[model samples]
Target: MNDSSSGRTRDPSPAAEDPDLVRARAGDDAAFGRLVAPLRRELHVHCYRMLGSVHDADDALQEALLRAWRGVGRHTGRGSLRSWLYAIATRTCLDAATTRRRRALPVDLGPASDRVPPDGVARTEVAWLGPYPDIAITTGPLGPHARYEQREAVELAFVAALQHLPGNQRAALLLFDVLGYSVAEIAAMMDTSTTSVNSALARARRMVAERVPPATQQQTLREIGDDRLRRLVTAFAAAFERRDVDALVALLAEDVTWSMPPLAQWYAGLDAVADFATEVPLGSCPSWRSLPTSANGQPAVAFYLGEDRTGTHHGWSVTVLTLRGDRVAGITSFVGEDHFVRFALPVSVGGETAVGRCS
Candidate 1:
């Protein structure tokens, strides 16, 4: 293996990840960029899973790339490029986690509110989990040893569970089980003994198993079938457009929960959710346009609202729906127009009906 800092060429074999390794090692910025392009999205998502914030993932990934670029010459390619990048990313997140509080949801704070909190959510007191753009999360087996499916790993339930573990345990668990790195490889990544890595993995698995539900959203969606799923999301969107409370309630579970982030106020049970709908959102007399989409590996819809249906309905929020059986079990509405950028969703819905995956 060659160590660039030593001004040596000990890399006798072609263990390099790319054929252009020579150029990348010689400080050709474009070559390095080209070399890492294919892995960027996956790497970013990996950071998001570690830190639980889209914004923090952006910063961590940027820093990791900078570090990786300067040190690329030392990557003698003894292992896969993917694992190397992941090692850098995971360490970067571990560093960030020490400074910031573990990301959280309103449920983690207290019992559900019977009514929307009047004082409003204080952002400083809460570190809400930001939604990840679906574009960055791909579906398929990440590697032979991976346990969770790509989408299943990103679900809100799974990400929330990861937050409870210590930073090292979190990194060890994600690297070994979710990303498919072996115990020996994870030991190297975390700079710990293989026995220590196994210990962390065992503790992490126990905690995550206790918190995560028996059934994942991906499995639920699979059983629903694509056509039925589309029709269901489309119908929910239509009901919102019409503000038909009865139709909306019909799709909800009797114990449905509705939460709006940045507000810290969540409603539980059918009656409470229906009351909030009648008194707040639906009662506001705003016309809505919803485009169905997917988030956190579950069904979602993006809303745009306006005084009338003529020009454009400005971006409102993205609602992710959780299901139990065939009914919506919970609704998490991440409010604010700021969420549009990640989805490549327009700030406003114009002439045509709002378009996306139809969830």
Candidate 2:
């Protein structure tokens, strides 16, 4: 088989090697690479959601790929190749999760004073989940698979909230809920009983509900195209950069929610969100810059600000904006420098002051 885009012939056909499927079954690395390479990006996204951290997902993906390559020869071809890879990837995530506690954002913790304490409280260790590369999620021609249809599950809030569950529970939930795996299949992959799988899934659901707010079940936001989201985000950037709280308020939904993670307190409603921005230190900062990015399949901004006499660009936060209709419904500000590189975001905005008005 060969990938036409890359122009690389990977592995010869099993039938070509052996009509009985004996030779190709006897350890062909080329065949194994061919089988898994096409699915790497999706598998990485899966691992990211399961682990709730991009760094962890990357590690788990590498491990899963290695395991799949080594074990591909043992395949009897009774199951779909995608399903088998998922089994391996899920197991790898479970193992990793078992070794580490679930990560939380600072917003998950209660808010402290905006002023830096002299003692300097250590930042919360909540698993600061990173955004997946847009190319990974949007790339390639998608088939009619259920996995392709459930792209929203990969969003930042969804993935970050997932970290609250225990590893096994996370695995069970994703397998059953997102991947639509059968109970018996999940049990086999988990090496546990069906009852246990059910229990894990239940716990996972409760945890997800508690951490990630219930999104509107209506399909209004799901159909939002990239262009529309970009326009809304640009408007937001322009309003904030120009210190036009009125315009900002106009763009927000009546019940918009504004949260800065690692700090659990959130402001709700357009009035409250507007007040928080205009009254808070974030609003008072003299110069602000925002670059467009996507997290969890939603529009986001990587924020930066001018600092002191040094002209250095101080890292501020990532705002993951959730849209409802043409308005902003939620804003999650993930603060700090550690998350920037992981998201593959630039340190500073290139030019212009406003959102759509970028030069």
| lDDT per model vs. reference | 0.80, 0.67
Model 1, C-alpha of 137: deviation from truth (Å):
1.4
Compare the candidates by lDDT and give the number of the best one: 1
Q: Cα RMSD to native, each candidate?
A: 7.2, 7.4
Candidate 1 local lDDT, residue 22: 67
lDDT score, residue 306, model 2? 63
Q: In order, how many clashes per candidate?
A: 0, 15
| TM-score, candidate number 1 | 0.90
Instruction: Give TM per candidate.
Output: 0.90, 0.75
